[model samples]
Target: MIALLIRDLRLALRAGGGFGLGLAFFLILAVLVPLGVGPEPATLALIAPGILWVGALLACLLSLDRIFALDFEDGSLDLLATAPVPLEAVVTIKALAHWLTTGLPLVLISPVLGLLLFLPADAYLWLILSLLLGTPALSVIGTFGAALTVGLKRGGLLMSLLVLPLYIPTLVFGAEVVSRGAQGLAVNTPLALLAGITAGAVALLPFASALVLRINLR
Candidate 1:
């Protein structure tokens, strides 16, 4: 499982890998939104939470298809299915890899993006904390979507369609945490909900993803 995790990470970081693509898209969104919305600091601060959360969520989608597509294409997935490590663990590791490559960078860079958006000073910590708690779920859920569409050609669009609805709860709770934090309001409820979603997705979704992958592989 460790080997598989490392392998996936290496593949994602390699030249022409999609590792940088998601981050680039995220940066572009942060830069363009300020330009489009004009230079009003109050307005920018007001919308910053939603904008950053939405950007991170969409950026995650950019690499969802690649989670299993390359291995599936090269016939490595079949061998993995037959390996000693359980498919559930394999699915979990893949999701972790995706999170490491796609989600972690976004979380780390979000504060800088927040500055660009004129985000409230107090909200920066909440933004990072919310993203930290929410992005793993995004990766795990995206793994399930990828598993569902793994065998289909041109499946990326379909995967996005399937995953976007599932993303709403996390997005809403995550954005709410930051929004409330910015306002100096209580954030415990939304933060707890976001954490719960991530925990539940991490605990259960890998099994579901493995089951879907098995069905698709057959």
Candidate 2:
């Protein structure tokens, strides 16, 4: 499992732009948002939490296809399926790698982006906390989406379509955590809910993803 995790993380790093692409996308969103939404700090502050969460979610989405596509194409996935490691474990490790590479970067950089949106000072920690807890769910759900579409040549659009609806709950609760914190409202409920979603995804989605991948491979 450790080897698989390292292998995927290394592949993601060495695979040209995959390593930085999501971070770049997040940065670009942060830059373009102010221009598109006008210079009103008040308006920016109002929407800042949602914008950051949405951008991070989309950035994570951008890399979902690559989660399994390279291995599927090169036949490594076939080999893994036959190896001793359980397919569910493989799926879980892949999701973990994706989160480490993509989601973690987005969480680390979001605080800086929040400033550009005039995010309230009090909300920074909440934004970071929300992202830390919520982004794992994105990766796991995205892996399921990827597994479902891995056999298709043109799966990127289809994967996005499949995953976006599933992402709504995470987005709502995650954005709410920060938005409520920014407004000085009680954020405990949303934060707890976001953690629950993440936990549920981590526990249940890997098996579903593995089942989908095995079916696709067969």
Candidate 3:
């Protein structure tokens, strides 16, 4: 499982393997939104949390297909399925690799992006905390979407359709955490909810993803 994790990370870092694509897209979204929305600091600050959350969510989608597509294409997935490592563990590791490559960068870079959006100074910590709690769910849920679509050609659009609805809970709670934090309100409710969603997704989604991958592989 560790070897598989390392291999996936290495693959993601390779050119054309989707390591930087999501980050680039995220940066572009942050840069373009300010240009399009005008320079009013108040207005930018008001929308910053939602915009950042949405950008991170969409950026995650950019690499969802890559989670399984390359391995599926080269027949490596079949080999992994038959290996001693359980498919559930493989699915979990794939999600972890996705988070490390796509989600982690987004979390790290979000503060810089926040500055562009005039995000409230007090909100930065909550923004990072919310993203830290929420992005693992995004990766795990995205892995499920990828597993569902792995055997189909041109599945990226379909995977996005399938995954977006599932992403709503995480997006809502995550954005709410930052919004309330920025307002100096109690964030405990939404923060707890976001953390719960991530915990549940990480704990349970890998089994479902593995089952879906098995079905698709067959």
Candidate 4:
């Protein structure tokens, strides 16, 4: 299991298709915003948090297909299904590795792009915090969609159809905390809820993802 996790992480990083592509997409979204909304720093500041959150969410979605695609194509997924480790554990490790590779890096880079949006210094910490708390859910839920669509050659639309709606609550509370923090308001409520979503995803998504993976493998 440890080997599978490490190999997948290494492959994702080296392939320039998982975290790498998502990060590039994230950068593009951050850069395009000022162009779309105009160059006013104040206006950028006003939209920075939401822009960052939305961009990160979309970027996370971009790599969902790769989660199980390679494994399925190479027959590793079938081997994985036969492993002594429970399918839920296999799903959990994969999600954790995905988060480590994609979600974590996006959270790390947000503050820098956030500066382009004129995000205040105070909001940076909370924005990063909220992303750190919220993005695991995005990654885990995406894994479930990826698992479900593993055997389908053209399931990208269906993957988004299945997983994007699940992303709404995470996006809402994550943006709310950043907006509130920028306004010097207490962001505890939204931040706590974001944390709750992360916890809930971690606890529940593996079972869901495993079930989907099983169906695909069968």
Candidate 5:
């Protein structure tokens, strides 16, 4: 599992391997939103949590198709499936790698983007915390979506369609945590809900992803 994890990380860091694409997309959203919404600090602050969470979610979605598409195309996924390691573990590892490359960076840099959105002082820590807790679910659910469509050409659109609905609960609770924090409201409930969603996705989605992947491989 460690070997597979390392291999996916290495591949993601290579040229055209999607290491920075999501981050770049995220940065672009951070920059463009102010222009579209006008430059009022008050308005920016009002919507910052929602904007940032949505941007992060969409950025994470941008690379879901690449999770297994490359390996499946090149026959590596088949080899992994036939190896001693369980396909469920392979799916879990890929989700972990994807989170490391895409979601972790987003979490680390969210504060910088938050500044652009004039995020409230109290919300900054919550924003980062919410993202850290929630982005793993994005990667895991995305892997399941990717597995379902890995064999189709132009599967990116289909993957997004399939996965966006699954993302709503996370998005709601995650953004709620930040929004409530920004308002200095009690955020324990939403924050706990966000954590629960992530835990459930991590524990259960890999099995579903692996099942879909096996079917696709056959």
Candidate 6:
């Protein structure tokens, strides 16, 4: 399981597709925000938190299929099922690898994108911090969505349908943290709520992903 995690992370990093695609999606969203909401700097700042949160959510969506699609196609997934570790452990590792590849870079780069959106100076730190705290849960949740639809021909859309609604609370509180911070208000309430959601997802998603993996492997 650890081996699989290492392999996936190395391949994703070397190929650059994981980070490239996610960042591109994030950048595209950031670029579009001004167009959608008008170019006034104040309006841009007003909406920046929501924009970043939405971009991050969609970026999470964009790379989600890769979590298990390549392995399932190449038969590594099949081999993984027969390995000694628990499927849940394997899924957890895969989720972690996916987060490292697709999410960590996004979190790391979010501040730059936040600046592009005219985000308030005060909120910039919270934006990056919120993503760092919240995005692992996005990957963890995305893995379960990936597992549920790994083998279906039309799974991609279904994966979005399944996982996006689950992302709402994280999105809400994550953006709220930045929004509050921008106004020089109390930020911890929403930030703490976002953390709670992440903890809940991490604790629960692997087991759920494992259940679906078992069903798919059958």
- Which candidate has the highest lDDT of all? 2
Local distance difference test, each candidate: 0.95, 0.96, 0.95, 0.89, 0.95, 0.89
lDDT of 1 by residue, 139-215 (tens): 99999999999999899999999999999999999999999999999999999999999999999999899999999
Model 6: pairs clashing at backbone N, Cα or C within 3 Å: none
lDDT per residue for candidate 4 within 19-99, as digits (tens), equals 578888999998898999999999999999889999999998988888888888999889878878898988888888888
Decide which is better by TM-score, 3 or 4. 3
Error of 1 at 93 (Å): 0.1
lDDT of 3 by residue, 107-196 (tens): 999999999999999999999999999999999999999999999988999999999999999999999999999998999999999999
Residue-pair clashes per prediction, in order, are 0, 0, 0, 0, 0, 0
TM-score of each: 0.99, 0.99, 0.99, 0.96, 0.99, 0.96
Error of 6 at 208 (Å): 0.9
Ten-residue stretch with the least lDDT total in model 3: 11-20
Residue 13 local lDDT, model 1? 82
Candidate 2 local Cα displacement, residue 214, angstroms:
0.6
CA deviation > 4 Å runs, candidate 3: none
Residues 1-218 of candidate 6: C-alpha lDDT, one tens digit per residue: 66777788788878554657888889988988888878899999999998898888899899899888888999988888998889999999988988887788888889988888899999988998899989988999999999999999979999999999989899999999999999999998999999999999999889989999999989
Candidate 5 lDDT over 70-175, as tens digits, reads 9998999999999999999999999999999999999998999999999999999999999999999999999999999999998999899999999999999999
Cα RMSD for candidates in order? 0.6, 0.7, 0.7, 1.1, 0.6, 1.3
Tell me the deviation in Å of residue 114 in model 4.
0.8
Estimate the lDDT of model 6: 0.89
Deviating ranges (above 4 Å) for candidate 6: 16-18
Q: Tens digits of per-residue lDDT for model 2 on 74-165?
A: 99999999999999999999999999999999999999999889999999999999999999999999999999999998999999999999
Error of 2 at 99 (Å): 0.2
